[model samples]
Target: MRPALYWIRRDLRLADNPALHAAARAGRPVIPVYIHAPAEAGDWAPGSASNWWLHHSLQALADALAARGLPLIVREGESLATIVELIAETGAEAVHWNRLYEPARIEHDTRVKQRLKAEGIDAHSHNAALLHEPWTIQTGTGGDYKAFTPFWRACRRQAEPAPPLSVPTDLAAPDGARDLAGAVVPPAGITAPLDALDLLPRVDWAEGLRRTWQPGEQGAQDRLGGFMETALADYREGREQPAVAGTSRLSPHLHHGEISPRQIWQAVQTQLARHGAEGDRLDSAEMFLSEIGWREFAQHVLYHHPEFPDAPLNPRFADFPWQEDPGDQLLGAWQRGETGIPLVDAGMRELYTTGWMHNRVRMVVGSFLVKNLRLPWQAGEAWFWETLVDADLASNSLGWQWVAGSGADAAPYFRVFNPIRQGERFDADGAYIAQWLPALAGLPAKHRQAPWQAPASVLGDAGVTLGVHYPHPLVDLKESRQAALAAFEQIKKGA
Candidate 1:
């Protein structure tokens, strides 16, 4: 049998990886290769946290594959060039990979497959990233779904569970194959290098992230088991309280393809089935599943449109007037988590400090940056790209646009989130804020949200000086809302 190559991109796991399984099943020698695609070859590539996590995750993957007596060959530079040359060097008759849907990746993968076909080698791809391949969902009239309700309904109807694939027990590399020494790309965009993201925590407090998140098939299983044991039960309440453990926090795992949506979806389903849908546990499971639905919808849009990252699905807002200038003070404040709005600043700091933020706060801060500041959504997107560890093209684009009211079935243009109210409601008693923003840690619950409004004596009493320790609100909420409403009027009028 001719040797086969499994090119691992986003789907890093041995289990439930279509490419890995197919390559193993080829009844021939299988050499699995992970090509760290040259998206950010120089200074323009991956973020601090993503790079940090990638390093650790890849290490875990290598250890796991090594344990199973397999070698995950690493390659750098143009993926197609590497894979094609790889096929030639190894005398491989077939190349198998899980598909990716980003526009740039689509173009690259298409060219790779076309070239492989010309050379008489089989290049097969599978839908391993999403639970339902984006192409599969459609409307009653055979059109792509423009709204999430219809898209999600179509997804739920598939009903057949996405069962996990068993790990391959053994594999062999190509004979005398020394053409590849496993080079890596630089941390995106920069020409000269630092090291692989599979390496460090770009920041601190990551001992928990490091401890909680291990990035491989086995690690994903362990995380899932632990969630089922303790946290999955309180996910609903936890999701609401940023101070507590509520969400799966497995987004980065899914983003890195360290785990599959199949694993997560099935895990949630199994847990829910065991519980009879009566209380917070079941409600939380349902909510988390819906979050997955959003992920599905993002892919569905990306699959159909293919131009999502650069363009908006809702075109009316495409050319909407946005202020662009040399300096963005508001943008600066927002990015640094110094906006002085307790909730907004806290969320930004969380993102900067931890490379992750509570989802509710993600919405609030995103809205403040884009709408309240009358800034471009892409600006926020760019900042998010650099900052978030869980920043996925599909999920991040969908989320940024949704927050900006420029995505399909998005939050209405008029429904600007009141950050204060959101914090007060979801984070009642101000515990979440205090946990993240320790300057306000000493404030009584009632005064935490609007600390600046409290008397100067209150600041003195807490040993927190307002202007010295923290800035006051950059813009008054009431005035900012009026300005945003005005901008919305113009956007609605012409956009």
Candidate 2:
């Protein structure tokens, strides 16, 4: 059998990995490799949180592959040059990898493939990132679906994916006549790169992220199992309540291909089969599934519309006047979880300490920064990029657009999320805030919901002083709401 090189990119795990399965099936010695791309390769880069997770994941993966008697080769820098060198050294005729839908990635791989084919080498790419390839789902005129509901409906109507392929334990690569070994290390003169290359939280305060999430394959599977067993029953509840473990926090896993969406989909299908797919699981499962769709949708949009990430998706919003970070104080306040807004601060602090945030406050805080503070969506997007372990380009960008009301299928410009109302409604008992911000732990749950309104006596009693123990509401809701509404009105009216 011809030798094959299995290039590991985002897909990190051994089980249910289609590209890895294919490479091993040749019964050749599968040369497994991971190419650590530069963190600063692009404008929208992997943030600090992802890098921390990535470093540890690499360590975990190397150990896992070594246990299976396979060397997990770690290469840093340009993949094409390294692959060509590896192919020549091993005398391999073919190299296989999973497909990526990002526009830049597509361009990069296409050039690499063409270059290899010109040299008489076969380059294979598999669709393992998404359930359905971008071109597979289409509209009446053979155009891509722009809106999500129709696209999802079309996807649901089509045949589901074939069963996931399993990773074979015995695959090996044949050694070539020429001795070939290129151990990879950080490239020459790369000083203090961003942290996405390894697995650690961006913000250091998260005992929750450390306790709740594991960064490797085992962690991914354990999270899936835990969600299915304890938290999944109330996913909707758990998802929105930052205080509870309600939803499947499998995004970083899915993002990294540690666990394929198909595995997650199949898991949901299996559970729904036993649990009747009707009650909370239905809502939770479907809710979680919609998140997957959103991921696909972001990729779909970026794949088709190359400029979607850099600029506004809607053309008219191009000239929309928006502020960037107001000042270090403002951005710092938001980052340190002292926004004087309880839920926003809690979520921010949660991200600061743990490198993760609940989806509910993601919108609330995203809106508050963009809509209320009148900052640019890109600003918030970048913060999430740096802070969120699950930060994804498509999801993060599209989510910011949705919150900023400048994206496709986005929330209306007028619909600014009222942080106070949102906090009171979603985090009713203030349990979520109290969990992260211990200074307010003694306050009655009601005081947490509205700390500014509590009388001085109540503040003194709880050992909480407004703007001291906790910052007072930095931006008032009613005034900020009207201001945001006015700004959005201008954005809509082309003012």
Candidate 3:
């Protein structure tokens, strides 16, 4: 049998990887290869922060493959051209890879498969990323679902996902193959070392990211273990409070394919068994699974609506008057975390420094961007696509559209998030605000959420000057919110 090429995409890990397992089971020497083709990602290529995570994740994957006595071949160029050349050089007769749902990627992969089959080379794709492929779940009317609640309910009623596959105990390399995991010998004309890909930034802006994350398969498992041990108990409350380690923080790992959702689902089930008698634990576990379901829903929506990343799913938003702040001046301030709103700024700074944000805080800052600032939701989506390590195409589009009230089951257009109220309610003691906005750390907890509301004497005692030490609120929440409502109402009337 001819050797099989295991083309690595986002599904980076060996464990629970159906494509990798299938390639190995073909009874031929397996050639594991990863092609870095950012241009193919189109307008949503990996940004600086995500690139940093990718660099480390790839290195970790290389080490793991080496441990199993197989080499990882890394290349950078046009994916199809590079892979075809790889097939020629390696004498591989078949190629296997995990499927990606992004529109550009789907088009590219379809073309590649068609070309490979024409050339008499077998090509195959497997579902390693999502538990259920997008088309598999549908509404009672036999059409795609527009809302998450029913979509997830249908998902639950389907057969439970099978147990995750264990990593192959023995990986067979092609005869005459030498162990060369990190070594790079690309098809000559277009080959660069992983370091040469220049995924890291020149400036040292990643110290916080480094401290806050460990980006590999083992690191993902470790983070999940920590979350289960301490944070899972109060997960419902802990996830809401940004200051606490209440959430799993497994998103970047999930995005990079360092771990599979099936693995996570199975692990959560095991953890659930540990709390067999408790109702709260069961409820919290179910809630966490629903978050995963939301991710699935995002993919399903994006799969059906390929243009989701750039446009609103709801037709009414096409005519909605999106605010234009000349030069994106307001958007820039929000991105820089200098908007003078503690909770919003805190979430933005957290994302800038750590490449992750609390889900609740994400909603707060998203609402501020789309509604309070009245900026186009696309602007915020673009910024997040660049800043977030877990910047998934499906989720980013779904989340921003949800906040902007332009997607299915989105927050009602009239519902504008008042950042002050959100902060006071969620970050009641101001721990989250103080941690991210250290300039206002000395302020009493009551004043931390709204420094401008505090009395002049109180501000002086805290050693904070409204505009000097900390800037004043960018826009009055009440006034901006009304403006957003009026604008949305116009769209409604026209619709």
Candidate 4:
């Protein structure tokens, strides 16, 4: 029997991989292939941080496949062309892949599948990334859901997602297949080695990323295990505290498909069963799952409204007056963590160093960008795309739009976050702030949050200068909030 080619994309792992599972179960030898075609993703290509994660994740995937006696063929080219060449070289009878919901990917995959089918090859695409496919859930009137609560409720009304698939124990290599492990040049359609993908930075700037994350299936499982044991108990309250490790840091892993939502769902369910679902445990489990639900909602929204990444769901935002930053001075400060707002700066610095940010701080910084700074949300979105390891298109777009108050079920435009208050509420002791903004470490807890408000004596005692040690506030918070509200009023009036 001819072997089947499993085209790996975002779904990188072996265990719980629907495409790999189906290909393995076909009773024929399987050939796994990864095609690196960043341009195919269009403007939303994986950024530096994501690329760093990808480099290591692919290495991990390759090693795992080698352990199973199969070589993960790495190639750099147009995805369809690479797949076709691999099929011709290996004489594969079918192509199987997991689905991706990004508009560009969905369109490209559809075309690839149709073209393959026309050539008489079996083309199979399976749901491996999402708990429920976007089309599977709809409102009472048979339309896509615009709000998260009802969408989640509708999802819960459906049968529970099936348990995750186990890693196939019977992965057989095709006849004449050579183990291309560490091969500088492999024959038969292998164009470049993993290094040739150039998914790492030219400069060695990812040291912090290396320290913060382990980018593979094993690492993902380890994170989940750690979250369950250490944080699940107090997730509800703890997730709110930026200084606490209360939430699962499985985002980058999930974005890279090192772990599947179903796997997380199963893990959470197992915890509930083991500890008995009651009180805090149940609430925490439910709250955590709702986050996963939000991820689903974001993807579904992207699927139904393909313009989500670039345009607002609410048309009124099209004419909303966004402040002009002539030289990106405002944006540059925010990006560099020199915004002079401790909470916002800490979040930006954390993202720069770790390729991840605490959720609460993310909202705070996002609000500061779109509201307090009155800059275009897309500017912030683009920065995040280039920086965050978990820079998922769906989530990134939804998040920015949500903060801008121009998305479906978005926060009201009037709700501008006060960075000082946010810091006091979430990072009261300034632990999160100090960790990222060490220059402000000497300040009192209250002063750390808003050094501009500190007395001259307090500033002197802390060895801090307003502009030299920590930059002065870029914009007055109260004045900016009023300005943002006035601008919002214009959009509200369709001016």
Under the 3 Å rule for N, CA and C atoms, how many clashes does model 2 have? 25
The collision pairs in model 3 are none
Residue-wise C-alpha lDDT for candidate 3, range 236-306, written one tens digit per residue: 77788888888899999999999888988988898988777378887788888898999999999999999
Give the poorly placed runs of model 4, Cα more than 4 Å off: 177-192
lDDT minimum window of 10 residues, candidate 1:
185-194
Question: For model 3, how big is the CA root-mean-square deviation?
Answer: 2.8
lDDT of each: 0.76, 0.76, 0.87, 0.90
Q: Against the hidden true structure, what lDDT does model 1 obtain?
A: 0.76
Q: Name model 3 segments beyond 4 Å from true.
A: 175-192
Clashing pairs in 4: none
For TM-score, candidate 2 versus 4, the one ahead is: 4
Prediction 3 TM-score vs. true: 0.96
Number of the predicted model whose lDDT against the real structure is largest: 4
In candidate 2, what are the lDDT values of residues 373-409, reduced to their tens digit?
Answer: 7777877888899878898888888889888777868
In what order do the candidates fall by TM-score, top score first?
A: 4, 3, 2, 1
**lDDT tens readout by residue for model 1, 1-495:** 678888877776878888888887845677777677657232236666677777777767766765654556766768778887787777887899998877677777888899889988888998888878777777888889878887887888887765888776655544434313434322122121124423465445565456445666667677778777788877767777777767777788888787888888778778878876668877778777888888889888867776666677778787677756457777898888888888988888878776788898889998888777778888888888877888787788888888888887788877888888888888879987887789998887777888888888888888878888878888788888888878778768644
Candidate 3 overall Cα lDDT vs. reference? Answer: 0.87
Q: What is the lDDT of residue 29 in candidate 2?
A: 67
Q: List the candidate 1 regions with Cα displacement exceeding 4 Å.
A: 40-45, 179-212, 277-281, 324-326
Superposed by TM-score, candidate 4 places the C-alpha of residue 180 at a distance from the truth, in angstroms, of: 8.9
RMSD versus native structure for model 2: 4.1
Candidate 2 global TM-score: 0.92
Winner by lDDT between candidate 4 and candidate 3: 4
